[model samples]
Target: MATASMADKAKAKADTLIDEAEIASSASAGDVQAELENLRRDIAALTQTLASFGSGKIKEAGMRASEIGAEAADASVQYAENARSSFLSAEQDLEAHIRNKPLQAIAIAAGVGFLAALLSRR
Candidate 1:
């Protein structure tokens, strides 16, 4: 009769422990779900902020590229005009030299022609 009482007491204690474990698990699950919701909201806000920053950076980069392109085009036009002026000035100098020394210019031209013919033969 005493053994039977001891077994009944043990079974009641086991049932009490199981019930407490289940209650604790339910509370922890609620806390975990709330934390998940908070994390999701935080992630969404970060995504929006990053997107705004990216858009602004893209606009800034495009404007900078346009300005650089315009500068390059202007520089190219100026360089072409400078090259034309230099070519015309060199032509005028050559004409003046030939007028001042016709015999020397003819001798130089004949020597250049002879050198060109010799190089072409080889």
Candidate 2:
């Protein structure tokens, strides 16, 4: 009878330990689920932040490109104006030279025409 009683007590103790272990494991599972939810929310917020940052960077790049294009256009216009001024100055100088020496200008023109006719024959 003593041995039977000891065996029954050991079985009851084992059952109690199993119940405690189950309760602890359930508590740990709930904590893990809550952590997973928090992680999901953090990831969502990070993605939104990165998307906004990328959008802002894209807009900034586009504005910079537009500014560069405008600068290039302005430079081209300035260069064209400079070229026109240079050409007009050269034309006026040539006209003044011709007016100052009409006989010499006629002689030079005849010489250029003779050279052109000679080259065409070849």
Quote the RMSD, in angstroms, for model 1.
8.2
Residue-wise C-alpha lDDT for candidate 2, range 1-122, written one tens digit per residue = 99999999999999999999998877877798999999999999999999999999999999999999999999999999999999999999999999999999999999999999999999
Give the lDDT of residue 92 in candidate 1. 99
Name the regions of candidate 2 deviating beyond 4 angstroms. 1-28
What would the TM-scores of all predictions be? Answer: 0.68, 0.70
Q: Lowest summed lDDT over 10 consecutive residues: which window, candidate 2?
A: 23-32
Candidate 1 positional error at 67, Å: 1.4
**Candidate 1 global lDDT:** 0.98
Q: Evaluated with TM-score, which candidate comes out highest? A: 2
Per-residue accuracy of model 1 over 2-100 as CA lDDT, tens digit each: 999999999999999999999887787779899999999999999999999999999999999999999999999999999999999999999999999
Clashing pairs in 2: none
Location of the lowest summed lDDT over 10 successive residues in candidate 1:
23-32
